[model samples]
Target: VAKPVFMSCNDRQHSLAFGLPGMVERLNHLHIQYTDFDDLGVSHDTIRSKDIDVAMQLGKHANDQLYTFYSASPSGWLMELGWGNYEKPAAQEHYTGDIFGHAVEASGYGLDLEL
Candidate 1:
């Protein structure tokens, strides 16, 4: 994901983490404050096997199409992660951050919620 993972305090202080696929596992193993939300249907058994701390069970949101859960971050804040049915922009990028086809400029501050 190109987006940065963040934890904010009082709407001011923030901590950012950018990681790859197994970043969640690394965060858990390190006991760092971080949250992991799954969209795209992660295997519950797989998550459990990793012994990740689960703060909430799988559920849907009131104004979202996400199938997600919450995890307690080491920083004492809830880290929200999830996937949704929002249509991907008609643009593609390679794993090396190379743009392919057309590029779409996506902008938002908080979660990009569509209702």
Candidate 2:
């Protein structure tokens, strides 16, 4: 399994409600493929019922609390569908430096998660 990496806005509520869920819904409506593996035994019919494609099986990340699955987008990039309690204290900046020790390969370059 690949390590989980993603961008997060300081406002967790907006990110979770509008940012993530809205985007996922768009991808689904557009019939774009995405990665999701959080729910084990999630069948092909289930995916098609939502008008989405599954790119990875259900699994939990080792570095974070996100239980997620991966999906291949229409542009061929992977979109992660994750759910978890990842909110940190509002006073603190949520950043991790090299916690996974390597970047995830995407396209021809490495996707850096430390930014």
For model 2, which pairs clash? Answer: 34-71, 35-69, 35-70, 35-71, 36-69, 36-70, 37-57, 37-58, 37-69
Residue-wise lDDT of candidate 1 within 1-115, one digit each (tens)?
Answer: 4334434342211324333233432331111221344322454445557775555555544332345544445553334345444332222521322112112122121222221
Candidates in order have lDDT scores of 0.36, 0.39
For residues 1-113, could you state the per-residue lDDT of candidate 2 as single tens digits? 22332334553322222112213322221111224443423543465478654544445544444455554556644445555555444544453432232233222212222
The alpha-carbon deviation from the true structure for residue 60 of candidate 2, after best TM-score superposition, in angstroms, is: 0.6
lDDT of 2: 0.39
Show where candidate 2 strays beyond 4 Å: 1-8, 11-45, 48-53, 87-115
